[model samples]
Target: MTVINVNESNFKQQVLDADVPVLVDFWAEWCGPCRAMAPVLEDYANDHAGKVVIAKLNVDENPNLAGQYRITSIPALKLFSKGEVAAEVIGARPKAQLEKDLAGHVA
Candidate 1:
């Protein structure tokens, strides 16, 4: 599946109201790491398809949502389950490591 582009308007429905867990990548176009993680996120979204929802929220475009989540950095990854944040990963990392870090939440 393709990664969803999340914004303030659809944030609630796409992530909060999702039946399955949601992995949200808080990113910005200007961030190098955020750009680097784009393909990784795409691959992960495809692999996890129905199991989890992968989304991208551009911080530059949605500062309110980013501030609400207390995102202090770009490429911040948050795993949300049951409408709440289950885990968070700051900065970019390898897919294996990212999966390992979110193993419990996704499983």
Candidate 2:
């Protein structure tokens, strides 16, 4: 599964109302780390298909949503479970580390 592009229009339904845990990557086009993490996120989307929903919200385009989440940095990954944030990962990291960090939440 490819990472879904989320925006203000679909944030509620895609993340908040999702049946599975959702990992929302709050990023912007100009963020170098965000760009670097793109492939890592894609791999997780494909590897963890059906178990978790991976989505990306461009901070530049979804300022309101970013503000609501209090996202102070780019490439911020927030895991949502049962309509609320369950865990968060900031900055870029190796795929292995990311998976390890999210192990408890995703499982």
Candidate 3:
């Protein structure tokens, strides 16, 4: 499945209200690290479809979300479970590490 574009408008239903856990990628268009991790996120989304909700929040377009989560850096990966943040990773990392970081939630 393609990644969900989570904004203030549908953030609730897409993330908070979902039955499955959510992987929210907080990124902006100009961030190098964020761009680098895009494909890795997509592959994970495809691999984990139906089991988890993969969402992307553009920090440039949705500053409120970034600020609300206190996302001080680009490429902030946050995992949401049952309406609250379950885990997180900052900066770009290998797919194995990303999966390992979220093993409890996704595996």
Using Cα atoms with residue i matched to residue i, what is each candidate's TM-score against the true structure? 0.95, 0.97, 0.95
Q: In model 3, state the lDDT of residue 12.
A: 86
Compose the digit string of candidate 2's lDDT tens values, residues 26-85: 999999999999999989888988899889999999999999999998899999999999
Candidate 1 lDDT, 16-55, residue by residue in tens:
9999999999999889999999888888888788888888
Taken over the whole model, the C-alpha lDDT of each candidate is 0.90, 0.93, 0.90
For candidate 1, the lDDT comes to 0.90
**Which candidate leads in lDDT?**
2
Q: What CA root-mean-square deviation does each model show from the true structure?
A: 0.9, 0.8, 1.0
Candidate 1, residue 11: Cα displacement in angstroms equals: 0.6
Tell me the deviation in Å of residue 73 in model 1: 0.8
lDDT of 3 by residue, 1-107 (tens): 85888998999899989899999999998899999999999888888888887899999898888899999988999999999999999999988888898897885
Clashes of 1: 0
Order of candidate numbers by TM-score, starting with the best: 2, 1, 3
Q: What is the alpha-carbon lDDT of model 2 when measured against the actual structure? A: 0.93
Candidate that would win on TM-score = 2
